[model samples]
Target: MPETNPQSRTGLAFGGDYNPEQWPEAVWSEDVRLMREAGVTMVSVGIFSWALLEPAPGVYEFGWLDRVLDLLHENGIRVDLGTPTVAPPAWFYREHPEALPVTADGTRHAFGSRGAICHSNTHYRAAAASITTRLATRYADHPALALWHVHNEYGVPVSACYCESCAAHFRRWLADAHGTVEALNEAWGTAFWGQHYTGFDQVDPPRATPTVGNPAQALDYRRFADATMRENFVAERDILHRLAPGVPVTTNFMTALSQCDSVDYWAWGREVDLVTNDHYLMTDGRRTHVNLAMAADLTRSVAGGAPWLLLEHSTSGVNWQPRNPAKAPGQMARNSLSHVARGSEGALFFQWRQSRRGAEKFHSSMLPHAGTDSRVWREVVELGSTIGALAPVAGTRTVADVAVLWDWHSWWAQNLQWRPSEDHDARERADTFYEALYDRHLTVDFAHPEGDLSAYPLVVVPALYLMTEAAADNLRRYVESGGTLLVSYFSGIVDEHDAVHEGP
Candidate 1:
């Protein structure tokens, strides 16, 4: 029953996450005025506001959010409304302490930080669903609503929770995946360690164990953990879809290899209505722009070569990094435009205004603490104008000259214990290959291992380590059909179950 195509109303989104709740009502007018001045078109709202939105169980304070959306609408700025499910209210945690995630070593994560929910916990799921339903029912018809931004960058800070609930859920998942304990045992190679299971109830998550856990078990656990979070995402996404029919729903992805290694974006890409990414420059002495290009290309590929949004990037340095040096003058504009060049609908940052207090207070923002007279603010305004001028580029696709094969499952398996070499990093291999192609001025489109590859003339597999037979056959067909294939060392060595392929 909700309105749709909010993106059609605003050509290219040009704003960042707006946390008006952090400021006083008196500052709202100034915020709107500044947004208009900077040519801001859209802002993501209510991402981490669960505590303030719902002060107590079943009680939601929607008046402030209503005013914020109304103000943005009055200024013709669109809203990417968030569900605030990432950080459950402290009261909810206090009530359901079991919802907190437990690590592999049996250490329970405290609730002071964000994204600590045990994805398998029924209470957490119910709470998340309730909040998402309430938001969808309330804001489905809001004038400024453009997109529904689901839970923030999932699989970050916390990915897998090794708790009893998760163990039970993992067993159910294994049962469904393998159909029987016999198949699971055969696939896990439990015979080697005398760890065969007769019943599904006997199995548990690959928690901390002596002499390293089973490689296949660890691999499957990663898949289970990813699927668990995905189940939660699909639940919330379906709620949004049903409540707000025409409106597109998306959760921002940290698609870069180093940012989030647990999530499989290939599977996630099929779920969201629109693909959006939050990319932060590593600034780790490597060419940051190359990494940015890689992230943008990877995100676009996840969108199936369709245009995607650069949902969140820092205006300058981030607080979490070892050396948070500020961006050089004009560097912000360059960084934003590079993404736009690689099929981003528009450029947006982590936040609109620099926070006065919080863990991310020092993270650079569109409106810095130095105010409008500062260089960051000036660059923000200039970038907004630049993006506005490039409105004609919206909905356009970026053509690629080459295809890069990437798989999160392969990365996960390679990262597990007891590999051929600890120095052989999957992400490093990917970056090296991508950087080479980028330097050669060849546009790259990343593809899933088993995805369609006929369109690409040159396909490069940087490092696979784990490859299913279907993917291997797919690559073979591509090569046989006159497509050039370049595979790196240690690729196609093991099957999806971490079992080595029988043939040489």
Candidate 2:
């Protein structure tokens, strides 16, 4: 009902992920009624609508989607339409073998979960762009549409793609960085056991035996993969940006997932009109607010301290973890409030209504199994009402005193090669740094490697395994200029090429 903007003072946007596609048209009105009862102001529709939209490639079905959008419009709910690239239609994947993701073990994954496509596939990008373009062009002027939700949770446990296209691109990337194979060989420390590459193709991604061969090589490939995925996000969102010029676009980022470097994700955030992310803390985990605060601060930092939407969070409990944990009676409200206190613009749950089947059937929602009368639903409604009443208080900022260098390249450099210490995993190290800063209420933002370093009073560079000479100089200058810098144990241990570097 209101125009959405970074500065728009709409109270914390409170709603859960909605899927009108799951049920028949007869249930649409009932869902809308329930949503209004729950005080839902926004709806993230079509997160998995590839199958619904393009039952056949190039054939668009707007009838069902049209009804869904129009109904929500009449009900005064904003829609954040997902691009649906995470789960391309089965027909598209079945026809385009290139769309399949290549695992580190050289296995091509079959379609099962969302985010299964190889980020390096050009054909996948083209097809995905076509669908994204269609959505943007059709809904550009639709006031009901508030944001563009790019590919759902682009996690990457499938490992890096060594497909021909990716391989060629990797080689070109190497050429630009190292100039020649000999230079690459020296940089990756190929002389360790005569693992030198004669040319770019000789370099293999970290997988199977390659990870054991060289940590530096493996690290660079990890960097490559991170960049590749970020590029995919940028490529897809750029289409929407061009076609639908006014709407804010963002991918829902998972704060500490192994699938991507958050630093690289920050790079992808530059293309987004605003930053949005999902935060799910295991109810049993210690200090859940630690990472949650870091994520909120990181989101604000990515958008230049602008507010970001809390895209998706478990309404009651998460089922994906090894042991699913439900949020305690007042925990959801506390968690949502904590995010706002720490600096989130708004908080949204994963699903408004629980699923009836599929992997997520057991996941909690605002409308639980007992229908809209359940406690979960009631809490959601109450929170929604409160947010509506306190919209002005919902969008305030948390002024951060600390800045952490969250360079994905550094993450790739450390883990790409085989490191002896398993505890020093990039994600873990990044979390450790964030947790330390957060423990002191020092709001922190993850700075991209290319971001200007002059903004923060304090900068922490943790576990910089692979850093360019230029980046090192930037840090040096920052510190020399009276900026308080905290370097971790393994800082600047490797060059950009992944070769180990000694102390000064």
Q: What is the TM-score of each candidate against the true structure?
A: 0.98, 0.91
Candidate 1 weakest lDDT stretch, 10 residues: 1-10
**What does candidate 1's lDDT look like per residue over 1-504, in tens digits?**
233345453457799999998999999999999999999989999999889889999888999999999888878888999999999988998899999999999999997889998999999999999999999999988878989999999999998999999999999999999999999999999998799899999998988898888999999999999999999999999999999888999999999877998899989999998999999989689999999999999999999998899999999989998989899999999989999999889998899999999899999999999999999999899999999999998888888999999999999888889888997777888999999999999999999999999999999998899999999899989999999999999899888899998975
lDDT of 2 by residue, 1-504 (tens): 433442232666778788877777798899888888877878788888899898997999978888788888888788888888888888888888777877666788788766677777888888888988898888777767888888887654454676667777787777887899988877777888878788787765665773366766666676677677778788877888888877778888765433235346656667777777788885446577676666667667767777777877776877877888777788888888777776666678888778898888888888888886677877887888776776777656666677787766677656643476867876676778888777676767777545677878988877766677887888888878888888877777767666666766
Q: Rate the local accuracy (lDDT) of all candidates.
A: 0.92, 0.75
Winner by lDDT:
1
Poorest stretch of ten by lDDT in candidate 2: 1-10
Write down the lDDT that model 1 would get. 0.92
- Which residue runs does candidate 2 get wrong by more than 4 Å? 1-9, 157-159, 257-263, 425-439, 448-457
* Model 1 TM-score, all chains together: 0.98
Q: Over the full model, what C-alpha lDDT does candidate 2 score relative to the true structure?
A: 0.75
